[model samples]
Target: MDLKNVDLNLLVVFNDLLNTGRVGQTAERLGMTQPAVSNCLARLRRLLGDDLFIRTQQGMVPTPYAEALAEPVSYALGAIHSALNQSVVFDPARSRQNFVIAMTDIGEIHFLPALMARLAAVAPGVSVSTVRNLSIDLPREMEAGNVHLAIGLLPDLQTGFFQRRLFGQHYVCLYRHGHPLDHPGGMTLEDFTAAEHVGVVAAGTGHGIVDDLLARMGVARRLRLQVPHFVAVGHILRNTDMVATVPQVLAQCIAGPFGLSWCAHPVSLPEVSIGLFWHSKFHRDAANQWLRAQIVAIRPDGVDGGRTEDGATAL
Candidate 1:
């Protein structure tokens, strides 16, 4: 338990091994030799008094003890990184940082175009990449500095992280422009529930909330098609007869491009709150701060002084 006697560099190797699950891959990622990585693992196992990972046909699998240590180790490294780089200056135009953001396909359509354009004009040297929210261990990745920020209606991230509300949106039923349900007066409840629906069943996403709400109100959708994500919703709805209930921002972004249209949901559903999220470890990091500012500048009309029940507004 003596911090000065133990090599903290081994923890970096340990975290990489936890993520990659392969010694060779971890070595490559950390710019070390395979034997060096193996030595680090050995050192870590000795220091921790357990075999952290075991080799198997699948890959190097972490033991239960290692799984338990993942969060604390990641957080410790984050704090160490924050402390060491506190005085680093970030010049957006000169920096070649590639930021990884977590979001859904809905976010790509609604935000990326404007965001990329803004980056091109201001921080041309900087680039952005995205991973699907909730598809991976987002919290761990953020703590490990793998994911810089997450932009979406991510409830899981509301706690133990800092977030700034981007916007508030409601659900709208989307369909082809000339579909029968595309009426000016809006479709009645009976018609809405009876119509064949294109349901989105993305795991742990806010889209499922509306479905649960309908069920609570004793309304059932005739789900003719169920998709894992909203990436293909617009394309499918543009050519099909089925309608989908989605965030109003997503609908607006796709309606014109996909030859689609939307109307307010027939059933009352709570509003969706999108936010800009990052781990507290990177709250004051210059590069992270600049990235956040860029996102805010691109869409400043979002809730400036709003606070969510989860304390998710700029904390």
Candidate 2:
């Protein structure tokens, strides 16, 4: 068969035939006459050299050849339909989309409560799945549509990524409520350096960001223990006499419940900013835009600041 001579409408007829089975129903669905559908099916049979559908009292049963063609033909037509409908308005309230987000546990602690409440009230049918972005290949995941958004401090994104800064987190010193340093004046520089510390390392090795900043200032804390996750800090601080220099958000999150109190860090350190990131492949995608808008709307201060170097919204 000549490729250029083949009628693509015949493929559409074949797809509808595979779906509805009865020629009358297929014609009604395609908005065509039954005779026109039959003609297209006949042409499809001749082009493929197969009787495609066998008419029986049980309705039209697909032949082995038609059954083999079913999946690819359906997928191709679905892709084409999606491509043509790219500009359609996305209605989140009725959509059953599952948005996958890549984030650290810290990000989950700070972001999930409000996000879930918003989803429950607005887009209830939309579900969310979270994957920790430790060492995962995020660029490949985003490009393949496996990851919809990445939340938290992702400083290593390559060229095609977009981001929006949600807030900046300053460093603070967290310790048990009564083990001494909860004075009115807070811990002094000497008292901070002398205290035994609990270190949380997200990088899986070496010291944390606080340590690097302190090292630059010719000061070092006595780190008696080190852990990889942020959740452990509360328990460790509550039971032990050790102190932790952590992001203010995390310190505040774990402080009250664990009988811990936090004060401003004695040393100067750069504030860590958290952001929402996604691949540019989804920049103009309607559903993605809806989700991003929801996130931006609930930002802590509800203010649009400046833009980051990579064109991310800063707030």
RMSD of 1: 3.2
TM-score of predicted structure 1: 0.86
Summarize candidate 1's per-residue lDDT along 53-80 as a digit string, tens digits: 9999989999999999876886787788
* Model 2: pairs clashing at backbone N, Cα or C within 3 Å: none
lDDT of the candidates, in the order given = 0.84, 0.79
Model 2 residue runs over 4 Å out of place are: 1-86, 204-207, 306-315
lDDT of 2: 0.79
Instruction: Give TM per candidate.
Output: 0.86, 0.69
Model 2, total clashes: 0
**Deviation in Å, model 1, residue 220 alpha carbon:** 1.5
lDDT of 2 by residue, 175-196 (tens): 9999788888988899998899
Clashes of each: 0, 0
Question: Tell me, what's the RMSD of every candidate?
Answer: 3.2, 11.8
| Candidate 2's TM-score | 0.69
